[model samples]
Target chain A: NAGVTQTPKFRILKIGQSMTLQCAQDMNHNYMYWYRQDPGMGLKLIYYSVGAGITDKGEVPNGYNVSRSTTEDFPLRLELAAPSQTSVYFCASSLSGGDTEAFFGQGTRLTVV
Target chain B: TQLLEQSPQFLSIQEGENLTVYCNSSSVFSSLQWYRQEPGEGPVLLVTVVTGGEVKKLKRLTFQFGDARKDSSLHITAAQPGDTGLYLCAGGRNNLFFGTGTRLTVIP
Candidate 1:
């Protein structure tokens, strides 16, 4: 299994620009999450989905959105990107939430100028 | 939101030395796990401890969960350069919460 996969290993966006960070998992996990990590920091949840058609905001979900239309896909959208959004984003999935092993993508390094 | 705090945020040691990293939280967790991450890469799971006061060992690394279920520790013996990386501890049954992480560097 490819496990979890994220598109565009790196990207740079201008202020007010919008883009989507694509994430997909082949493990058929029920839980998918989007997290951002600043330089020398821990992961902060942006959004998460428990299952298809169910998405919820996390600690830092102000400038982002997420959609889970299929069991294998969960994409994160960045609207009106700002410089503060510059960070490394990671997509992860697990069979279920809580105490389960999560498989993570290599990460998408995003820079908003 | 539950918070997990890790101590000794940074450490550097000579090869073959031993070290321990701690993770503490005011909130209790059903389970806790340890993960190691390298530069430009995502974290990889090292181990998981669920039972209070549980201890698990893998090769030169040992992991323990606090008896109160509010803390955890990771110990590495005979550390090597390969063990040099960012170690993170996460807990929570509803959502995964991560600690700030401990950066370890082993010099040969």
Candidate 2:
């Protein structure tokens, strides 16, 4: 069973280019999150959705946006990619929020040039 | 804001040796989880501790939660090369907050 899947395992984006990091889960979970990990740093939350059509900003939400149009999909969009945006992105989902185990995807490695 | 801090940002040890990693926080949590991530991979859950002063064992790894639910520790006995990875601790109340992480390299 595919717990969580992210598309475009690796990508290189030119400055000011826009791209969408696709994330989908088959676990029927209600809680989905987007996080980015920089070298030698912990994962920082970007955006999260508690359910369909309900999204919220996280600690580091600048230069990014997210949409949860369905229960199985939570996509992150970068309107204008910058050098500072290069990082490994992970998508995670949990059965519910708080005190529950989260399942993660393989991750997408994006490099903004 | 809630913060979780992990000690010994990096560690390298010989095989068969033991090591301990710590996670501390000023805010209390309802539960704490440990995860290990290898190169080019997302973090994978190792164990979770809920109750205060709880101790849970996963094979050669022992995880303990502090009595105040604001601290936790992970001890590995007889480390192996396969145990090399970045270990992270996450505390959860209404949301999950991750620690800085400890990078462990068990040299063979």
Predicted model with the maximum lDDT: 1
The prediction achieving the highest TM-score against the true structure is 1
Worst 10 residues of 1 chain B by lDDT: B90-99
Q: How high is the lDDT of residue A28 in model 2?
A: 99
Name the lDDT of candidate 2: 0.92
- Regions more than 4 Å wrong, model 2: none
Q: Work out the TM-score per prediction.
A: 0.98, 0.97
State the TM-score of the second chain for every model. 0.98, 0.97
Worst 10 residues of 2 chain A by lDDT: A94-103
lDDT of 1 by residue, B1-108 (tens): 888999999999999999999999999898999999999999999999999999999999999999999999999999999999999998766567789999999999
